[model samples]
Target chain A: EAGVVQSPRYKIIEKKQPVAFWCNPISGHNTLYWYLQNLGQGPELLIRYENEEAVDDSQLPKDRFSAERLKGVDSTLKIQPAELGDSAVYLCASSRTVYNEQFFGPGTRLTVL
Target chain B: SQQGEEDPQALSIQEGENATMNCSYKTSINNLQWYRQNSGRGLVHLILIRSNEREKHSGRLRVTLDTSKKSSSLLITASRAADTASYFCATDSGATNKLIFGTGTLLAVQP
Candidate 1:
């Protein structure tokens, strides 16, 4: 089976521009997650979805960042009016359930200039 | 912060040698997992050890968890150049679906 799939492996945009990343989780996976990873640091959770419901998203920056997992399979994370500090890798992962090990996708590397 | 800290930020060793990395977390957890990520690539799950378990082995990877100490260690025996990557430990909060990840250990095995 294929692992999680993400589009636009890398992206470059200027500050104040909007950018979005897409993710397609593994088949049959019911739990999805979006994470932000900075240079020399580990990934930090942005949001999580159990099916179509976003069960946890307290870490997400509501003012600029938004994420949605539609039909509990595909997800999109968008950053509007992006900032230089938002340059980092955005990762998507999925699991069969909340208790299972997650499978990650090759993240989208955003470079805000 | 919910993130954990890893010891020996970097490791370089000859092929066939053993490489050990440690991770320390601050909260009680239901389980701990290890992940490996090649340069510029996504992370892959390595191993998972529950709080009730102390040691678990998969192939050449051996993971030991010390819930009492709130720490875990991952040992890769007979390492190879292909093992060059970053290793991270993640702790499950047990209450939420979130995982607190450690800073990560950069391992470079020379062939």
Candidate 2:
């Protein structure tokens, strides 16, 4: 089976611009997650969706970051007015359930100048 | 905030040698997992050990979990150059099942 897929493997934008990243989860997976990984640091969870409902998003920066999984199979994470500090790798992962092993996508590397 | 911290920010080893990495985390966890990420790539799950489990092995990878100490260790025997990557330890804690990842250890295996 194919693994999770993400679009625009790399993106570059100027500060204050809007940027969006898209993800497609593995087939039959019910849980999807978005994470942010900075240089020399591990990934940090930004949001999680169980089916179409976002079960955990406490770590997400609501003021500038928003995410949605309308069909429960695909998800999109958007950052409005991106800042210089917003430059990092955005990873998407999916699993059959919350307790199952997660499969990750290649991730989108965003650079904000 | 990151919950886990890995020992040795970086390591260099020769092929056929053994590589070990340690991870220490705060708070209780249901399970701990190890993942490997190649340069500019996504993470790949390496192994997982439950809180109650002491040791588990998969091929050349061995993982040990000590809940009492809130720590875990990963051992890769007969390491190969292909093993050169960044390794991260993540803890599954609370009802949310959120994985709190460590800072990660970058391992370079010389061919």
* Shift of residue A56 alpha carbon in model 1, Å: 0.4
Q: Comparing to the true complex, what docking class would candidate 1 get?
A: medium
Best by TM-score: 2
lDDT for model 1 = 0.93
State TM-scores per candidate: 0.98, 0.98
After superposition, the stretches of candidate 2 with alpha carbons farther than 4 Å from their true spots are: none
lDDT per residue for candidate 2 within B29-104, as digits (tens), equals 9999999999656799999999889999999999999998999999999999999999999999856799999999
Tens digits of per-residue lDDT, candidate 1, B80-111, equal 99999999999997988579899999999999
List, residue by residue over A1-113, the lDDT tens digit for candidate 2.
99999999999999999999999999999999999999999999999999999999999999999999998889999999899999999999999999899999999999999
Candidate 1: list runs displaced more than 4 Å.
none
Q: How high is the DockQ of candidate 1? A: 0.76
- Clashes in model 1: which pairs? none
Error of 1 at A43 (Å): 0.6
